[model samples]
Target: MEQNPPKSIASIKEKLKKSREREEECATNLQLLRQDLIKARTAAIDVVMAHQKAVVKLDEELEENAKDLKNVHVHFLSEREALLSSFVGSLLRKEKATGKTPPQPDAPRFVAPLHTPTILCFLRTHLGKPGMLYCGRKVLECEDFMLKTNRERMELLFAQHRCFGCFLPLSVAGHLKLSDCPHPRYCAICDSKDHHQILCAARRVYQGVIPE
Candidate 1:
């Protein structure tokens, strides 16, 4: 004969309730893990986007740098060409100027009015004759009012470079039409600061032409 199974129904129901609670807890844990994985994937995607943005920014910066370099190169080349053109123009202008005649210096200076030696008045007043009449002689023989010593002085101190027909001594001032010289007062003929008997009027008259 099969005896009836001794059954604790309350214990059996309690075990079943515990198993359902474990299964619900496992499902909740799985859902939480899936949510955490989705959040991690989203974060990785955001990081990749950030990296891509950085790369794009770098590419733009490189492009800008290249453009700047190109502009600088063009500008420099243009400047160089302009400078070359300017230099060539300057050379052409120089050549043109060189082909023309050079500027000339100023002309020689023209001197003033001519000097003509006319007869002086000292011999007419005092000696009654020109100084030429007094040849190589003592001063007193010509009735010269100067003393014997002065006559000797005239004879010794001075001599004739030329027998100027109408010339007078530079010392005689009153009617002596004298002339000056460009050289230092060193000429032997005129015996004055001006020119000498070399250009004196008596020589010119004797030559029959007034010195121009």
Candidate 2:
């Protein structure tokens, strides 16, 4: 019985040692799992920050691109106005030199019905200071209704382009038509919803340099 008691005690001590080793193994595994979890969280934070930085850079590039496009449009309109004014002036001078009455200019028609009318015609027919009878009323008065109809048509065209004012893509603020303002329109700089570009302060600054 004494010998049997020692053997039983030895068996118990061996089991206890094995149990302690298992507990230590479990604790080491738990520590490794915690370390992995912390690394995952840190990596996720870094990814998010990198994504945000990329988005900011993209936005800045888009804004710069829009500004460049606006400048190009401005320059093109100025050149177009100068060319037209020169052509018209030359025609008038030639007629006066020949001692012949200058025939009234007619607005040139467009080949595509969907396109905006020639700028010269819109200026002569819709914005002329002198009154000429057309369909019982003055030409300008008669063309007012036509201009409004054309304005609606131009909305879709404007939608395809960016806004000159905010240098962003054009939004629901109804597409501003070139006919709504004077020649070489400065609609991009004007903020007034009620007034045309002719009344804009920015427009006035460049008044005489560009033809009307």
Candidate 3:
């Protein structure tokens, strides 16, 4: 028989082969792990990018909603002004047809019958010349429920009128009627749109309403 290979050498060779196989298996496992990590990182990046895009879209939608809300508010205010103007015009037309002298805005005495119209007047003092400005009459005394208190009725009447300054006609709507003025809706002390002459508390006050 051929001389047998040295036992020690045979054992050493077997161990070397086993170690190489184990190294190859480890290398394969390491490569697979590296590939798995790369995939995981790529998926995480995609998720972050999607989240960022969604956030940007949400902000844009919110901005659009805000603009729509602002537009609605402006529209509502404009419509309210138009309605008030239209109501005043209607009253003026009624007066013209009846040939009745509607209650003057500056008259001190609140002498309007139920459902009678009261004119709101404005004076353009800033136009280099003091000119009388009048808006169409707005109806003050409506044939509605009888108010209980004098103060309540007075407040309601005041609410129907407006005065601009210590001396302005055609006040914005909702001026308080001055008790001291000759005209029903005018201020005697200060031609203001909101308060009585006594309560006007202005440094300068108008003495009386201009003669019609």
**Candidate number achieving the greatest TM-score relative to the actual structure:** 2
* TM-score of each candidate structure, all chains considered together: 0.41, 0.48, 0.47
Task: Please state the error at residue 144 of candidate 1 in Å.
Answer: 91
Best-performing candidate as measured by lDDT: 2
Model 1 Cα lDDT, one tens digit per residue, 1-212:
23333355666778899999999999999999999999999999999999999999999999999767755654454345346545655665787778964344395221111232333223323434555443333222222212222122223223421122223453543332324322222333233335422232222122323222
Q: Please give the clash total of every predicted structure, in order.
A: 3, 0, 23
lDDT of 2: 0.48
Q: Pairing residues by index, what is the TM-score of model 2? A: 0.48
How well does candidate 1 match the true structure in TM-score terms?
Answer: 0.41
Looking at model 3, residue 140 earns an lDDT score of 35
Model 3's number of clashes is 23
lDDT of 3: 0.47
The lDDT, on a scale of 0 to 1, for candidate 1 is 0.44
